[model samples]
Target chain A: MNPLLRVEKLEVVYGRAITSIQGISLEAHKGEIVALLGTNGAGKSTTLRAISGFLGLDDARVTEGAIHFKDNSLANRPPYLITKLGIVLVPERDKVFPNLSVVENLSAPVATAGANRKRLEEMAFTFFPKLAELRGRTAGLLSGGERQMLALASALVCGPELLLVDELSLGLAPVVVEDLAQRLVEIRDKLGITILLVEQNATVALSIADRGYVLENGRVVLDGDAARLKSHGDIQEFYLGGAGERRSYRDVKQYRRSRRWYG
Target chain B: MQLAINIAVLTAIYALIACGYVLIYRVSRVLNLAHGELMMLSAYLLITTASLFSKTPFIALGAAIFLSLCVGVLVYLFLMRRMTGEMVLAAVLTTVALGVLLRGLVVLIWSAQQQNPAQALGWVNHSLPVFGGRISAAGAALIATTALVYVGLFLFLRFSRYGIRMRAAGQNPLLAAQRGISLHVIYALAWGLSTLTGALAGILISLDSGLDSTMVLIGLKAFPAALVGGLDSLVGALLGSLIIAAAEVLMIYYVDALLSDVVPFLVLILMLVFRPWGLFGTREELDRV
Candidate 1:
């Protein structure tokens, strides 16, 4: 089957001296979740922003690249046009209109997208029942988890075919992260929509992703099945802690000692 | 009793002009400082059109409104569209330039003379009894016009889909675009409505007094109306105008005549000191970068 989305040699240069991402290529198939795992300062979010057309063309220029969304070229299109073409990006920083209520936030995409306003709203509410209960509450009053849920609901309200979720688990509690991850899996399973999740949380991303790519210093260092990558020696040593040996209560103390020595 | 009627008439006129200023400012977030100039120009246009046509008063009024809408749209497309971003100061200054240009253009066309169109429009008549004293026909017409404009604005904003979209665009342009509402179309509509309001206010003012270049200064009165009402609130504009007008009238009668001019400035200063967001504006709007 043809890939739902394709990025060919995507190079994003921040300035004259700083190259954020260099020669990165990836493909995401329909009805699958592809996680882009990376450390801090990795080009994961940069790649996502470039695809969504949020970053400035002149400053953080896409020096050499082409992005294909369902066979349509999206390299030079404006952000709104890209959204119209059925690709929605839930930005990293949860850019919700602070003063507007939850209902207004959900209704905003309807006003802009102009299709499936009713059905998509119902679908969003189903995925996030908490949102349905607090539809009248202003977005400013929502907690961190609720805000993330609202952001996700707002993006889904647009009824995007391909959802590019950036930093879904960022700055949330562990329990909240797990809940979000479960919801993402349930969404993919039930809705048959494609997802490209860019995240810094290696474990949580790999836990839900069908396939994962490890980005280091703006280049893809590893790409394989999620299950295999989870068990990979280097991944276990650095990211997952160890294979078949979870960090126990006593092991946590020893790990802290090693971490301090390494530091 | 005569003083009371005079104060009521003045309050109604001030409220009408304030409403128009607030409407345009709410949607576009740009202070059309030339708004007063637009009012003056439309009044002049109405006078010229009435003299040239010698037609029915209703037809002449229709022609004036049509002309003002056209001028408003032209201003948006030619001037306002070119001014964007943090250069709101530049945008305001450009409007000031437009005001000067408008005043100069009117002077050249009409020879800088004050002309009365109320006689031609058949508004000149004997005074009608109000509480215990009498009010002139023109003063009554101004109040009637204000009521008509208010009801029209209320229905347009509350029921019309485009009107709702315009309000949405004003509140958040990016979000509005996400739902396929073009900011340009909304801006044009806002300009059209704003011009319509200004023209109507100008006609009403001309009926009360004669039309002159100094009529443009009436727009300045709207600045205080906007400030007192809260720049973003239509209701605020109406209330603010009433307060300012009543205060001005009362000050002229009871305090000092000069206080009528100074009152709006005093209200503005007080608002700036305590509630810089005006009466209805949010903190976010005031802190917008």
Candidate 2:
């Protein structure tokens, strides 16, 4: 069966000369949680931006590449058009409208054509019960975790078939991140929605993701099933931080040298 | 009692015009300095249409109002569209330049002479007594129109889906755009609504008094009401209009008559000095402006 979303050799460039990401390809089948893992400046966000149609705002564009959603080309389209096509991105920052009440934030997004808005809103409340309690509260006043929940819930109200999440655990406590991770799995399993999660925290991302890709310097350097990636030697050394060895300081230096050689 | 009536009349006039300022400024963060000139241009449209459709006064008035709304949309599509993504100061200056161009165009088309639409339409301007205070027919109509416009606007912004999107756009335009809300459509709608309200003010004022370049000053004066209330808040505009109008009317009665022209600005300055966001405006609005 064909993948739900396919991005073939996508290349994103900032302004005209600065290439942020090049030859990046990935896929997510329906009902799959695909984690795009990367450290800072790994171009994970840029990939998501390209897919979600937000690159235009930053003078960025897909200089070379194609993004297909449900077999439809979404190359260089406006963000709203991409959104209407069932892809929604919950941005890392300014995730919620600060001044709007929680209810208003949910109501603000233009749901997909033929979407049952009332049911979607009810589903959002069910996924994030904390949001229901703060329905009347201004989004800016909510706690960090609550704000993230609101952002996720609002995105859900858009009736997205593919949800692109950027840095889901950016500033949240581990416990909060864990709960959010569980909810993400629940969302994918219960709603049958595909998720492309871009995260720096590999442990959290792999814990829920069905498959994962590790991006470094705008390239997908490693990709495999979540369990395979979790047990990979390179991932174990660098990401999971020494899988089973108490290495010496000399050994740590050797590992850094090896990373540079491989990178 | 007489003073109260004067204040009410003046407040109605200011509120009607001030909302135009709030609507545009709130949505785009650009102060439309050309509003006064646009209002006068509409009133002049009334004059041209009044003669064309002299027999049907309502048709002439409606045609002029409709034309004014079109002009606003055109302004956004042609003029302001280019200024999008440019500096806010550039957009504001564009309006200033637009105001100058419109002022010149109005004079060239209609001439500088003051023309009365009431006379052109063969309508009589009669002084009517209300609550022991005298008001012209146009003044009463202005008061009623202002109330209806405010209530309608309040409901539209609060309950309408488009209104929610507009507010959403105002707060975070990128997010709004990402959520499938068209920024251009929202901005254009805002400009259209603003000009409609401003045109209503101009049409009524010209119907009551006369239409000329001086009518632009009325539009300019009402801007302070919008500012004093908050550039983004409609409720603030209404309350600001009342405050500015009361101050102007009282100053004219108890102080110098010439002070009427300056009182609104004086009150505006005081409000700006203490609270740049106005009474009901979100505090971040000041930073955005």
Candidate 3:
């Protein structure tokens, strides 16, 4: 099956000087949860920014490479236009409007026309029942986990065909992250919406993702099935913190520099 | 009783104009320094419109108000739109430049003469007895308009989908865009609404007094009220306007009449020094401004 979203050799540059993402490519097939795993500065967020059409806000641009969703080229499209095209991004932070109540936040999304907005809102509550109880509370006052849930629920109200989530587990406890990860899977299964989840938490991402890509130094260094990646020695040593003879600090960069695989 | 009436009229003027500042500031975070010029321009438009719609005075008033709204949107589309994502200071400086340009343009077109829109429209500004104090027809209108605008704005912002989206956009523009809300549309709507409220203030004030470049000073005076109330809060604007108006009227009555012009600024300076965020503005709003 053709991928629902495709990033072809995506190259992103920030403020005309910094090449934050260079020749990075990835894809997510329909109804699949594809995790783009990376550490800090691995260009995970930049790739997401490029796909979501918000690169211009930060003086970043897609210098080369094309991002295609279904057949629409995303370059030069505004963020709202990208969203109207059914690609909605749930950013890691500042995801919810702080002053708006939970109910208002859910209604704020300019969802696709003909979509049953009321039903979607109801479905959001069904998925994250905690949000229903806090519907009247201002989003700013909500706990971090509740805020994340609100953010996710609000994103769902957009009726996206493709969801781009940046740093889903950041600043959350292990239990909350796990529950959120499970909710992501449930959302994909029920809605059949393709998801591109960027994360530094390989364990949580791989646990739910069907396919995974590991990015390092603005390049995709590894790609594989989630199960196989879980068993991969390099993934174990570096990403999952698996047991291994500790490599010397000086040789660590050399070890990472030589890492590569294809799944 | 008369002093109370005077305070009400003055507060009405300030609240109406102050909302223009608050609307634009809350949405796009741009301090529209050109608001005074725009308000003055609206009053001037009434003069031209009064000539065109001479047979229908109400029609002329409506045309002038509508024209002002169009000008506000045009300013955004033609000038302010280009400044988006550039820098906040750059956008604000552009407004200052806009104000200077408008000041010259109004003079060039209208010839620096005092024009009475009420007379041109053939309307009488009669004073009526109210609660043992007299209030001009225009003064009463200003008070009514201010109350309606505030009530209308409160409902629109609280209950309307566009209003919710507007607040959402103001709070987090990037996220708002990601949710399919067009920032340009929201910003443009803000400009249009802000200018509309400013136009109402200008036209009513012009009807009460007369019009010239000096009318811009009224818009300028309204800014301190907005700041005192908290630039983001409508309730703050009304309270700030009341506080400023009361101070000015009392100072004029007790101290020197010349002090009336200086009192608003004095209150503003004191507010800035003691509580820069205004009465209800968020603490971190200082950084955003």
Candidate 4:
């Protein structure tokens, strides 16, 4: 089966000077949950932005390589057109229209051309029932977890074939992150939609993701089954807090340095 | 009694024009300082159209309004479109320049003399008595048009799909685009609507008092009303217009006749000093402006 999204040697540059995403390649097959793991400025979000439409940085652009969604090339396309092509993004921040009511937020997205907006909105409410109850409440007044749920639901309301979530676990409790991660799995399984999740937390990401890629300094250094990545020494040491703390700082630094050298 | 009628008519005029300011600002966060000039231009269009459709006055009026809408869209496509990704200050200054250019263009095209659409259309600005006060037919129409426009806008922004999308675009444009809402279309729609309403104000005011370059001053005066109400809030604009209109008219009655032109700005200064966001506007919106 063909992958729903394919990024080949993608490179993003910011302000025409800084290279945010050096050559990077990744893919997400239909109905699979893929996690993009990285530290701050690892180009995880930049890669996601390139795939969805364009970088947030005003002068930033996909300077090299291409992104293919189905048969369509997503380069330089407007965000709304990208969305109409069925790739919806849940941005890292400012995801929901703060002043809008929960219902207004749900109803506002421009779903795929042929998709039934009513059904999508209902689907959103079903996935996040808490949103249905808070239909009249302002989005800004919602708690962080609630806001994340609304953000996801609204993205779903767009009837996306591929959902790109940036920093799904950012500023949220571990329990909440885990719960949302499970929801991501259910959404994929039930809707048969592909999900490319960009996250800093590897544990929650790997817990539900079918496959994962580790990006550092704009390069994809590791791509494998989620379980395999969980056991990888570098991932375990830097991402999962390591097996035991007694091992020490000198060895960990050497391990990181060696990993960077190989990368 | 005449004082109340005068205040109501002035409030309606200011309210109608103020929404034009609010509509454009709420969507793009750019103040179209050229709004007054655009309004005056629309009234002038009525003069040309009146002659074009000499036998049918209503057709001339309709054609003029339609032309105003097109001019608005054309302005966005040709001028404001370039400034979309640029700084807000740049866009505003461009509007300032556009205003000056348009003022010159209006004078060159329509000339600086007082032109009468009412006479051109073979119509009369009849003064009718109401509540023991008399109001010109055009004044009554202004109030009615203002009411209709606000109600239409309120309904459009609340429940309609495009309206919701427009609101979504206004609150967070990036998120709106991510949600598949086109910011360009929304911004263009705003400019079109803003100018449409401005046209109504200009056309009606010209019909009431005849038209000339001085109509721009009415457009400028309405700015304080929009500022006082809150630039982004329709409700704010409505209340703000009432406040500014009341102060301007009452000052003319109780204070000095010379204060009519200065009262709106005087009230504006106080509102700015006390509540910069206006009565109904969002506080953070001021920072963006």
Candidate 5:
């Protein structure tokens, strides 16, 4: 069977000069959580933005390659069309409408075709009951953790087949991030929704993602099963921060020179 | 008593027209400088339709109002739609140019003559007594229409799904679009509603007094009320109209008759200096523009 989303050799350019991302490839099958882990400016967000059709606002475009969702090419499509086609994005920032009340924010997104809006809303509330309590509160007044929950819940309200979440644990407490990560797993298991999670928190992402890809400077350097990645030597030294021995700066430079020779 | 009545009548005029500016500005952040010309055009539409359906005055009014709604939508779809993704100042200047073009067209088509639709429709502007002050029939209608329009708008925006979507679009267009709301449709609807309200104000005013180029000045004066109230807040528009109307009426009575035309703007400048966002407007709104 084909995967739900297939992105092959995707290249994105900003303002015709700067190439934000190039030749990045990934795929997500139905009912799986795939994590794209990277630090700032690693092009994780750009990949997600390309998939979700949000690059237009910044005058960026998917200049090369293709994003195929359920065998349909999604190139140069508007954000609303991309959303309506069942790929919903929970953006990195400004995820919820600040001025609107929680209920209004949830009500604002158009549900997927043939999906029951009220049922989806109820499903969202079921996943995060805290949102039910803060139904009347303005979204701007919510704390960082609560806002993240609201953002996740509102994304669910769109009834998407593929959910693209950018920076799920950003500006969030560790405990809150852990809980949200767990809830995300629960949501995928219960709703059978495919998820592409972009995150700087590699540990949290790997904990929930079935598969993982590590990005650096817009290129995918390594990818493998989550458990294998967790135990890998490079991941241990860099992402997991479990580098056992303290090496000198000269030793690090020597290691980098050897890495380029083989990498 | 007379002073109070004058204030009420002037308040009705300003509030009625001011909501038009608020409606368009709030949704799209484009100030329709041609609103005065558009308002005048609607009155002229009323004249043509009234003559066509002279026996059925209500039908003529309805047809004219409906045509004005179409005009507003077409204006956005054909002209202002091109201005989307451009700078805010450019869009505003386009409206100014549209107003100029429309003014020349109105004179060319309708011939700059002072005419009364009520006379053609065979209706008298009867003076009626209310609370010890006399009110003309059209003046009373203007007050009632303004009150009804405000209440209807308040209810529509607060409770309706489309209204919530409109507010959503106004706050964040990118987010709104991502959520599956069409920005073009929302913007077009705003333009239609704004022109519809302005048309109503124009139609009623022309029926009260004779229609001429001077009607454009009344439309222009009402803009300060919208600004004073906060360009985005409907409730602010209402309150701002009352404040400016009171100032203008009082100034004309005691200070100078010529002061009436300038008082609303003087109040607008004061509001700008003290509270650029207006009374009920969000402070962050000042930076968005």
Candidate 6:
């Protein structure tokens, strides 16, 4: 019944004048997937970085409020300590140690957490059978989809109670995203691991997420059940670029152009 | 046969110093350019302590090692920690200054005089026939001590938890910290171990010839050894040391004696050109720089 993770008024600032996230509050309950949807510069990744403690205190700090994981205050905790507390973040960059083999990459998180190494490997393999086959290969050689799988698998190997995934469907083919979405559902159902997924792909995320929060300009603009948010006119207007007409060709073209400019 | 014995003795000494350099560099990724100076400091400490305790050479040696470890820890906490920044040049310069300071301090303490502790140990300078040549007691001890140190380090690295943590810290400090391995503790341990090896090698070399400020230059020989062996590979250090020592000795005999001074540097350059990662280091390691 209790929430697995809670973030209350979490505000992050980049510099003296630049505020990334103004005031964001969110929660993830036990055995539920919560997707954080936002446009570019919506402070989604920054929020995750702040919660995970990867951002150094000087360069990036939570200017106000607190983040609690399973009732423990994680506002000022170091990144390693946060990891030790069982909230594992699979960062957006797929920051796998390239020289290390897939097995080594998987083992690193587990080893750092001091988990049961054998059980971790077994559980990771169960979720990603492809990883088991490519265990000997270096993570550098893996495809984007495969790398995402490895990244997810590596985090799960820690046996984390809550998994914070940043942009899981980023840069993947449509079919690959579908495959990952299915796996995410199966993982939640089978392992009972809570997930907080930050995504730019609203449709894919909403399809799997139990509940969703639509963020715009660092503030939560909409929050409700996934089905309700998908049908909400405002949500469709902001994220999908329109309510009906299946997203105009001109709009899609403009979106792609903007993506290239930003990217 | 005399030639073989000399080569073996020289190889063992080179290997000992190379191990010290490699250990520090592998973990810290800093060249520790003043490492040779640390060795010089330890040798002077041993010489001074030996003079005071004229009746106990072994006691003096033990005390010297302990003192060197303390000095190493002190250097890490006070000097190395403060030298951290984006510019490695600043760190390298700091080490250079420390080396100069150590060398000057040695001169102030011991003067420019060359001192020998062989008499303090009451070991007569006599050579026994081995491999159709005479092998002195000092040569035998040097080889024996080198072998003991190498084997001890091997066992410690393979079996000890601290040693494993040290290796892990070297490979990935962030990952090591995530696992609760303290970086400060590992760095101190690394410096202590390296200083011990360096000091022991310096003392042994001093015994072979005599202790003087110039003995510090012997630490430079380790640079080539580390390069050839792969900065991260202990076995590479040994192999590289042997190769450098053999080349130097052979050059002194067959080539011009004057060219021996340049052999190690030449070998380092050639190795860098052919295998920049050294013989044992991974290519990925080069990308880190």
For lDDT, the strongest prediction is 3
User: lDDT tens string, model 5, A19-79?
Assistant: 9987888889999999998779989999998988852346888999899999689977878
Preferred candidate (DockQ higher): 4 or 6: 4
lDDT tens digits by residue: candidate 3, B225-286: 99999999889999999999999999999999999889999999999999999998878898
What tens digits encode model 2's per-residue C-alpha lDDT throughout A1-263? 89999988889888788999878888899999999987899899999989988523477889887889996999788788888889999999998988889998999998899999999999999999988889899989999999999999999999999999999999999999999999999999899999999998888998999999988888888888999989888887678776675767767655542222111
Better lDDT candidate (1, 2):
2
* Deviation (Å) of A176 in candidate 5: 0.9
lDDT comparing candidate 2 with the true structure: 0.89
> Each model: TM-score of chain B?
0.93, 0.98, 0.99, 0.98, 0.97, 0.94
lDDT of 2 by residue, B1-289 (tens): 8888888889999999999999988887889999999999999999999999999999999999999999999999999987654567889999999999999999999999989999999999999987888988999899999999999999888788888888888877778877877788899999999999999999999999897899889999999999888888898999999999999998888889989888988998898889988988878777854
lDDT digits (tens) for residues B128-218 of candidate 6 = 7886898877788889989999999988875576776676566665544443345677888988999988888887887777777887778
- Candidate 3 or 5, higher DockQ? 3
Q: Per-residue CA lDDT of candidate 4, range A1-263, in tens? A: 77878888888888889999888888899888999998998989888777777524266688888889999989778788999999999999899999899999988999999999888988998999988889999999999999999999999999999999999999999889888988998999899988999989898899889999999899988889998999888788789987666776657555553343221
lDDT of 6 by residue, A160-248 (tens): 77888899888999999999999989989998988999999998899999999877778776788899988877677667666565666
Clashing pairs in 3: none
For candidate 2, the docking band is medium
- The interface RMSD values of the models, given in order, are 4.4, 2.0, 1.3, 2.0, 1.9, 5.0
Docking class of 3: medium
In model 2, which runs have C-alpha deviations exceeding 4 angstroms? Answer: A15-17, A55-57, A243-253, A256-263
Q: What is candidate 1's local distance difference test score?
A: 0.78
Docking class of 4: medium
DockQ for every model comes to 0.20, 0.57, 0.77, 0.68, 0.58, 0.18
Error of 6 at B150 (Å): 5.4
Tell me which of candidates 2 and 4 scores higher on TM-score: 4
lDDT of 5 at B157: 81
TM-score for all models, in order of appearance: 0.82, 0.93, 0.97, 0.97, 0.96, 0.77
For candidate 2 chain B, the 10 contiguous residues with the lowest summed lDDT are B81-90
Winner on TM-score between 2 and 5 is 5
